[model samples]
Target chain A: MTRYLRDIFFALAALTIFVAASPVQAQSNSGPLRIEITEGVIEPLPFAIPEFIAGSSRVEDAASDITRVIAADLAGTGLFREIPRSAHISPITSFDSPVQYSDWQAINAQALITGSVSMEGGQLVVRFRLFDVFSQEPLGSGLQFVGDPDSWRRMAHNVADQVYERITGEGGYFDSRVTFVAEEGPKNARLKRIAIMDYDGANVQFLTDSRSLVLAPRFSPDGQSILYTSYETGFPQIYLMDLGTVRARVLDSQDGFMSFAPRFSPNGRSVVYSLETGGNTDIYLMDIASGRRTRLTDSPSIETAPSFSPDGSQIVFESDRSGSQQLYIMSASGGEARRISRNAGRYGTPVWSPRGDLIAFTNQQGGRFHIGVMRTDGGEERLLTSSFLDEGPTWAPNGRVIMFTRETAGADGAPAIYSVDISGRNLQRVSTPGMASDPSWSPLLQ
Target chain B: MKLFSKLIGVVALLALTACGGGGYFGDSPISGAPGGEAAGSADPNSVAYFNQTIGDRVLFVVDEHTLTSQARATLDDQADWLLRNMEFNILVEGHADEQGTREYNLALGARRAASVQTYLISRGITSGRIRTVSYGKERPIEICSAESCYSQNRRAVSVISAGPGA
Candidate 1:
């Protein structure tokens, strides 16, 4: 028999009063190592995002809309609350002058984001800088990006990226693109195809013509290729496409079997996929160069959704060999599989983090779907986001954020992509105009 | 989530062409039954009960299954006809827009079908006679990238089976 402790809550209440008057709370220290009362008391930084000053040119108003999108992208994370432009005491019309920090501080803004737009060599060039109001210094030098004026919105996202990184010490997700399946039509006769869009949903481009169903479009580590399963051949076959060149080729494998659920290895040298033969699905690895195939799992039960660890030494996949779908980690060369998820629900879509510390997976328990993560050792499982349906989590390059598709039921049932930090701090919807699914995050393209 | 898996499993089954012997569906007269039938008649030559208007579709709110006024109107006609015939049962296949997750769409689709089932039940149709399944967004009818296709895709289709009454 185990003993139960019922006095813990009461005991903690008495201890709180003693710690309140501790000497550590009396004096304030400014160094990085000082323990301050910032925990739980710290509030989100507030800043004003004035409409970007557009350059006088032949084009329409581009900078204002671009900056607005950037501001929305940054503020959507819930980390930075945007102060209304009405509260700004200083008008930041130019990017050349050093910011007056006192003016911002009076308005309670701890940070300021300023940028300029101009036409250089017939191309749009955007220069942007971010400042820390308290330190009264620029966090870093300003950055300039060149692209078509049509891509001004994307350039704005890049500017937001620079500011986000400087403040959070983490890489930004705004600069990447997500490739997913765009859907239309009835459930039984749904038409789907490959599509790509800017991280903020500005430029939605259909990559493949709608001929067959597509599932799980994963970007290569290098951001150059997409590996996905297409039903176009009348059977699920893994096709690898060079998205930059619009060149497509099927990853060569044996015929008479279906191959689905493809993801590139971390190093981008090999492809891990599920091959179905004789009614059984198993994980298989294919050499991208020689087209050689290696079976990783030999089981009668369904075993799909194979992902590689960052080091490419181990593979994490979902299998029902244990009577329920659970995450399993095995040597990349295929031996000694061990289960990682001990939760009550079946888990699938185990994506290893780029940092090699955790594996993000989809969990189904208590009739709800959740996106959760666990250490590589299968310890410390933490569910990040819970929803009606939140599956297919892909990792940000820094491994601090997880982005997945969240589709809600409605008269015109719609789906949207969403991202949450691993600490479950920032939960924001990544909006796309059309229905979006199977969102695989790309590594930092910068 | 369950419905999403079922939809995906059906899709995978379709991908593999590997479903066990179309059992229970192959021999049924509704298997190859063309659209139409005599009201409450059992004749094999009679068109299957519950005439489905071609290209008729229903709309859903964003990520929800509850029928809109338009969807209710569409289902109302079908429900009235099904009530008159008394022999028809329907399989409501729920679907979702492309913007959502697959499994949630499946659940959303199921919820949509259940919503229709509730509507039909409120309209005096037997709950036992109506079965609900969601294909999620796995199957879409429209292939284009416009609202024209999206509106058509988000629907609860009524597939009438040749049961006792019809």
Candidate 2:
């Protein structure tokens, strides 16, 4: 299995180079038109994914399930529309067989994904290949992933990621996870728990019971730990929990001081959060290992929601020092700060995108709350979502999408997680059993 | 009618106790209860009376934290009540409307609560007897989106406790 993986990786690298060297074909000339997905309205590229051919009867069900998941992952992005199986001119049956490219092309399936699943030593080995139906060539070399049967969904996501990367020329966030607050009960006395799930909102596992309120569960850079603020101790305090062991410990728990809104630094060696001392709130950074504390801002005005840039050289945060809440960027080590948001509204929760190109934030103006994005210099501000209350924007690993909490108004109001492309398209409500909020997207799985 | 009013008061007390902290509407009387000053502020010396009559909370404009004249007047009454009841300590919970970011609202809530604390201190209240926490936009008295509801939701409520420490 290990040898098979090595050979597949080499073949993929070689195929990628070959594709890069070839001249791109136009849709009029036909073969496969290399989708140049830049900006503007996107008509989803139509694709066909047949059921994986099972190598043995034992893996038959796993084969079909994996294929469905892979198709769903691609279709959910709104970038690719899956051609219905009913429209297929041919069905894929054998693991090793010649493809009928003409048949797929006749059905207008520009891309075809085929795979096989087999059981080896009580583990599942899934190999897949993507073909440009019109180009009459494999878009990327065939590859396989080996994992336990329970992780079949992850393996399927891996395949989808490869296809997405090949077609879009960008990394895929399909295999990531989201940590959010699951809410229940009434608005006045809502019960909230820390819950983590697959990026598509599956396999939900509650990390904490709803005994106490938990807010803002942020994944570490490595996706192995979570930083959140909890009122379990009867006051707001920052807690770090390892996802594997579920053991949590409070950080910088100084007596009489309230700490919340904690975010991990880019390197995961330190955390920046808001600490309230004697009725004054300011941003503080603390080393995870050394417990060294550095006060980032000493202003009498409130300073919080500190987010580190991808390079860790600077931090963007929300402050009211300008007489109203707004975004400000300052050196990570703490010094002179410059205001970033110059709009006529209160901007807060400024999160630097993983790509470090844009900053997503919550903006309140015109008697409405909006989740918006702006360039690093606070220019080109674009509001992606507006509603009764939309806030707390978290970026996908690739920074192409953002997930936030949108709550309806009135006595029955409740929050649910929603995601949208950076261009303000493909708005989707993430599936959750109950009301959910404060979604923090994890980096892609290793 | 007197017996009915007393029964209503008992039920209101029970509801408040069952709520653990407080209801979303604060001390607003429940449905079917008499809708006058007598129904809400029956206990003159109690916290319920303070909340419903003497004003346990102060409202703020959209994002502003500066105290209004009405807020100052309320704080003056709260200071006098705190002085008279020396056995009690207070926790001021600052809250914001649901129109802001979670963390930002928290900071705004803290600012609002601190504004109240500062006013009370200026009115001769001891600093050590008071503690402040910001709920941000998490808890709202009015969950609607209009300005009327937002104005009510952006408030800081003083919760009195038994001890001198918060």
Candidate 3:
């Protein structure tokens, strides 16, 4: 099966090269035309990511580590194929000069990637460039990253994002971080802590010790901080952690209430979270700097999983007021809540799309859990994934893809992170160290 | 009407016992009512009395740790069966639906098991005789990907073990 997949991948690579070589097929020979990707069946774009050239850092770690990570990030999507290093007859060594088109074409590589790393200004400087192998020209200028050596994985993702954007004509999600709950130990005595890792599950640094149970760590829009709920003082409370200094402080240390399901607004100033009082969970927005809490929902029902619209004008949350968990949208300033999910089942975790057009949520009905999307006006609902257990749908910065947690059935089942495009074309499982869940995506780092 | 609602709530909530620990009625000669001979006949370590066909596993409300009346009733019988069979030891596995966060689900599962443990203790079952673990939503009794399956998945499963006796 692996060999067959590899051959099929090579064929697709050859096809991409052919398409790139064919001059832009003008529809009217006067203006740019839109090619119908076709209905019901859209082809996954084929591209080639050759092994990146090692930088001149002279690092003790394996030089191929950075390149391998970058390749894995792109290929993990099942959208792009990395041409086997053995297939390339001419190796790319420099990013300053143009690539040899004929050499790339010989191996059925449609696109070419070349990267270099060097120590500059006391920091690791990484530069990567993407090229259209057939067009024999650079797709975009070389991307340069400056960070410490400890963040080499992030540098790789940043480069992968650049490559992804250049080829797919869309933003890349590789340069993002995923904050999730990391669990350990046995079932009854399991210990969970909040941990942050690169989008591809690298550099897993726990933000809190397992001394307390934590859940739902979400990154701020600036990617400099995270807001989550922790059961530190015997009750769940909101806490904010700054990524720059690895320092954390309490957000709203209210007495005798559980605050959870925290997420940052688009502007990154105010954080919206759920406050449970008298067993009733309601959405509340709190200013991180001023520590002022404003009640957003006054219903007696369970309202959690609050997320902000892209423009921060409104909010979407899950409520059981209608007898089952469903998505509702209300103004950021708080008012009458409008139900946005008119689906056949219960919906929770209604995250507005970064494009502000749709809300992604977890829908339960018909004896299964599904990740679905619907318009903000309660129309055009579409189910993206169906599984024994699939929940917590967080969007990539571009709103092109959604990442969620999927677990198998039975007591010994393991939970893992999975990403699927909104179109449901690309589905890939991102393997973490152990059972992973509640994945929240960081905004684009660049 | 309020009194009737409270009565119904009491009946529904009777699935759980007020105590923290005790073995439910069974076939053994521990310390409880005498209809537990069926469980007493099995090996002390064997799970012979657990009936998969009965299908009365306890259920939990969304994000709630307290047991509902129906769930309490089910656990009441479970406790009775355990008390009658002194040789039986139980392991309560807590679970949650996929609707909530993973870690919170784990905590909620713990809360559910703790509730069950408290009920068993109150019913005269020894606390040491019952072991508890919370799988959160990582494990599901049902395989569907919808709300119905999730509702069923949110539960605590009690596995009963007994020794040969009586």
Candidate 4:
């Protein structure tokens, strides 16, 4: 069974396709066709997707599901708005038929996506084409994907990803996964278990039981293993668990020290985390394979929540050295650091964006908490959401969105996962099983 | 009527007695009804006694790990008691109020627990006999948004168990 799964994973890893719609990887050079995404008000561009054409009766459900997922992916970005079918004048019936550009234009659909679903020898085949309706041209060549029927959502995401990239010039995060701590019971006795799910909170699979308290499950750079803090042995120590076998081994089990807040380097070769010894908490880096350790900060103050830059050259972390929790950037190797956050409130949980431009963090001031983002130099600081508690910001694969944990106040207060665009728009709650906190986004999957 | 029933429930629960230290205290142990095998506060070495009389925890201000005068007083008594009871190994669990980020709170809690450990070691308690862990803001003894609850929530508890020191 293991060998069979490894073989299938390899096929999916290659994203193998049996049908090649065309070998064209060129995009038409239309004038300023790409949406230059920035941190500001964006009018969600209008798009339309008709029901996918089904090649056979056995694949009707697959066709409709794929179309819906593709539409959902584009709409969830807050960058594109879907045009309902009721507003459409023409329904796409054949995959090869020419698009009724006039009909789509009548409804103000700037972009149109057309797809078809078919099955051959128990393999699901999906193909799609994106057209700039106003330009009356196919943005790029049509692409096809072939995979197991169980991976239908992934195929839909692939199609939507291509459409988004063709229109926005930005990478798509629809095909990624997120790992978080699923919670149960009350606030005081809340039981936590590590769970992994699709980006939209589907396919929830619990990695660990609620027996031991687990917090902050982060994905490795390769997304094949997870690093989190667990109380399995009555101490909060970081543990690495392989997703293949669902087995875990303690990464640091020092006899008297505690370890937590672990993050992977961009290359996935080493891990950086916080270690507490003699009551002094400082950041430490460990070579995962050799178990060798390096102390990055010898501060008498708190320094934790370390995140590596995209190039693995530097790390951004939180510290209270100057007397309050704030953000700082230092070299990946231990060295002098400079403070980055220059505001009235305390800043924490600094996460470097994948695009190497912005850092997201949690801000607290005037008795309220907020999820905010700033430039790499801590300039252009902007608060995204304000509530009782909004923290632990994780960046999406495209670096356009952020997901964090927002908690309520009072006796019956609870924590829920929420997300927003980096522009401080479209704040939406992400549904999970029961209460959840500490969300971490995975890199775009292969 | 809802508040009345809750008050009555609290009073009734405080009236029960047990030697174990799970749910046996509420402000003060009013259950010392001169009963059998209770190991009440009158018994110097019992956990029930340690929790009720000697005070097994120390509270802290928000974001501050420095021990207060009252906290130091409690640890002084705790160290004295722990020295007399050598078979009793204690696990120091540090906690925080739900006002900070999880990672920061965990680091803060570790500092708070380390403060308690330092005081106990100064009071001549062996480091091996005292183990420390931080729950961050995950567990709380009080559940409200006010300082009345936050003061109690931000605490370091020394839970005693009868075993050889690690």
DockQ result, candidate 2: 0.34
* Candidate 3 docking band: incorrect
- Model 2 chain A lDDT-worst window of ten: A7-16
Question: Per-residue alpha-carbon lDDT of model 4 for A27-118, expressed as tens digits?
Answer: 74353345767736378889999999999999999999999999988898888899998999998989878888999999999888988999
Please give the distance, in angstroms, between residue B140's alpha carbon in candidate 1 and its true position after superposition. 11
Worst 10 residues of 3 chain A by lDDT: A7-16
Candidate 4 TM-score over all chains jointly? 0.91
lDDT for A272 in candidate 1 is 93
lDDT of 3 by residue, A1-446 (tens): 33312211221111012122223432121221111211322543445555555555474242367788888877776666778887778766654555678988787677677767676666666666666666666665556776666566766776777666656556788877788888775442346778877777775777778877667788888877888876566445789987766678888777645577788989999999877554456788998778899998887666778899999899988777886677788899889889878868778778888888888988877667889888899898889999877888999888878999887754455578898878776778866888787789987764
Give the per-residue lDDT digits (tens) of candidate 1, residues A1-446. Answer: 01101100111111011111112321122212111211321356676666666566543367777778778877875667899888888897666665778998898877777776777677776766666666665556656776666556667777787667666666677777788888775443446778877666656777787665677799999887899877565445789988766567888545545577789988899999877653356789999999989988887666778899888899998877776678889999998799888978878889999888899988877656789899988898989888766789988776777888776644455567888878776788777766777888777664
What's the CA RMSD for each of the models?
16.1, 6.0, 12.0, 4.6
- Candidate 1 CAPRI grade: incorrect
Candidate 1 stretches with Cα past 4 Å from truth are A1-42, A51-60, A409-414, B1-166
Which ranking of candidates, highest TM-score first?
4, 2, 3, 1
Clashing pairs in 4: none
Q: How would the docking of model 4 be graded?
A: acceptable
What order do you get sorting by DockQ, best first? 4, 2, 1, 3
Candidate 3, residues B1-166, lDDT tens digits: the string is 3553344334322322322211221111121112322443354322323332222267877767788988887787777777766765665656787555454465466567767878878888887777665555545545454667777777777755443332
Best by DockQ: 4
